[model samples]
Target: MVTTRVTWDSLPDSIRRDIEARTGPLSSVEPVSSGFNSELAVVLRSADGATFVKGLRADHPRVWTQNREKAVNPHVRPVTAALRWSIDNDEWNLLAFEHTPGRHIDYSPGSLDLAKFVQSLRTLQELPCPDIELKLAEKRWASYTDSPELFAGDYVLHTEWSPSNVLVGDAALFVDWAWATRGAAWIDPACWVVWLIASGHSPQDAESWAAQIPSWNDAPADAVAAFAAAQAAMWSAIAEADPEPWIKDMAAAAQRWSESRRIGARSQTAR
Candidate 1:
């Protein structure tokens, strides 16, 4: 078994000290998923109850990323109903939020858990973010990826829609505020469906999951060619930059999406 090391001692002491000051001495620290950008730590405090602390790791330009969140969070505060606040170490950037309680559904496409994923993503799109740097969401995904029949216009920007990133308890709470922006709302769900289809799930299963989103009642109609293109561009970068096994999985799914689009288009023309 390959172990991913995430320990409280691995974080900067100065950062922990600052958290202690604010939350009033954390009693227990449980490291959660450190996905792509930050290390998620659930801190239980004596007086303050529970809080989430995301310690920014060095590699992925976190200071600028969190700074972007710092700028738009206030605007989205009322909309998302999720708190996003950044702390500065005068050298590094970390984000602290009120730990929303929920179950992190470990879902892939075709699972009933996909409903939570779609609802959470749509809610994020509904969030008012006039101050966000939309280009920040682009992340130059299209340039690296190749597909002759490109369909990149079916959604707002895809986020950390993977099952682990989504927490479902009282509600679907999307924790990662990074890589969020606007486009066609369907793009993210299409990406999720790709996850389902690739995970030994049939097209029927994919349709059931996609239909869970009322906006996507006609699942095939909702699966626009543009959505496939957008997903291909969005995920190809992760495949290149990270050594994570899931990235490889996404890359293959992206290519399959391209092929599926081509075949579907051709089948329609044949009629």
Candidate 2:
């Protein structure tokens, strides 16, 4: 299991004293891992209850993802209300949020509750995206383009999509909103299929998952292969550059995604 380190800025004696004075007494100032930002402090004060304080570090590749998503996400209302709320408030250059309690989705590797996952994706797509001026998210897939072949068709892709990125709870709460971008929505679901395969799940076992979205079966096979290759190359670079210990499995998953698409293509041709 990967254990993430949580840390916070040193509270000044004045702030501590103010907190103590306002609240009856001080409790614990524990750090939470809701993000990979400057610092995330889950300050729990007996006097004022709880607040998630996020310290935003300027000029971070990671934080830029969150800002980009949050800006355009307002166009995708209720499906992304939590996001819209954050952007509209403009509350923090370095910010704090009220913590809402929720649980992550619990599905064994390869056995995704895909029905719900696809529904969630559709909901995100259905959201009305008004014209907004958010900077476009950086494309994660590049290695596949190294070959002489042309790149995949126009797609607003999220290079990162796995069970880890999605935190399903009372309302399919998607945490780690850093990788949000415009891309072929198919890439996300195909990425999931790649993840399932690497974890020792049979494609047939994931038939329920496969059945959940006809789009998977219907999308052009070449597109699927391109997406898988693009996604794989993207994360491999990320892992190599600044490895996030939690994502060691991603490299293998990317390979499987690319391979699966190839196998799928061969089968299509055979018929």
Candidate 3:
């Protein structure tokens, strides 16, 4: 599913010309790093200003992701880079965004960024999920869950929490909406806990950090348990499919968190 990363010049001249027609002549195109989805991630400089460009081929199988992102941006704008323009042509489907320069988030234990991240999640959880077609988290995680019913809710969730997906400026800016889903409000914080664990926080530490977020804190204990187990299964399957180190690490983290939750549940029952 991974495509070769492309630079500015890698784009077809016709495609570039089409893009330039809308944004004026591009003075320069500097490629950005840390993106896993888009083949093209660059900052295009023009007479007016710089714009962030993210795109893949128009015919790519994953082109639907671009449509999903473009649809979701207006809803999550304050917590994300503003979507400036969208181009759809035979050559490429590119989206230009207001370039927001900031450091990618650090999820390591005790990092000040953790509090800010929770705050951003709170703000995001408040935004209404724009009425659009989206994968339901319950259905998406169904194969991994004992009771999929527990996953239903009216909140739109951004399920990807890789450190690179969030940039910290005055506030944490979440990027990449391709995996966004509609489901339980607490699911996003639950997703963050796995990334925090993978980033070197202990399972208990990650849970404590997540508790700072209201949705996570207020989640029903049984529902949280279901979520943990579902994620453990989900990540384990992903790691098995492709034994990439980071994916494998996430699988292990999710397993550990799931085990910890199970043990806690048992102890509380026994008491």
lDDT (CA) for every model shown? 0.58, 0.51, 0.89
- What TM-score would every model get versus the actual structure? 0.75, 0.70, 0.97
Model 3 lowest lDDT segment of ten:
1-10
lDDT of 2 at 4: 38
Higher-ranked by lDDT: 2 or 3: 3
Report the Cα lDDT for candidate 3: 0.89
Candidate number of the best TM-score: 3
State, as a TM-score between 0 and 1, how close model 2 is to the true structure.
Answer: 0.70
Off by over 4 Å in 1: 1-7, 10-13, 39-42, 57-60, 72-81, 108-110, 136-139, 144-158, 211-223, 226-230, 233-244
Model 2 worst lDDT run, 10 consecutive residues:
83-92
Candidate 3 residues 1-271, lDDT tens each? 3567887887788888888987898788888878788988988999979999899899888989999999999999878989999998787889989988889898987789988898899899889988988889879899998799888888888899988889998899999899889998988989989999999998999999888878887899999999999999999999989899999999999999999999999999999
How many clashing pairs does model 2 include?
5
lDDT of 1 at 1: 14
RMSD of each: 4.5, 5.2, 1.1
RMSD (Cα, Å) of model 1 = 4.5
**Which pairs in model 3 have colliding backbones?**
none
What TM value does model 1 have? 0.75
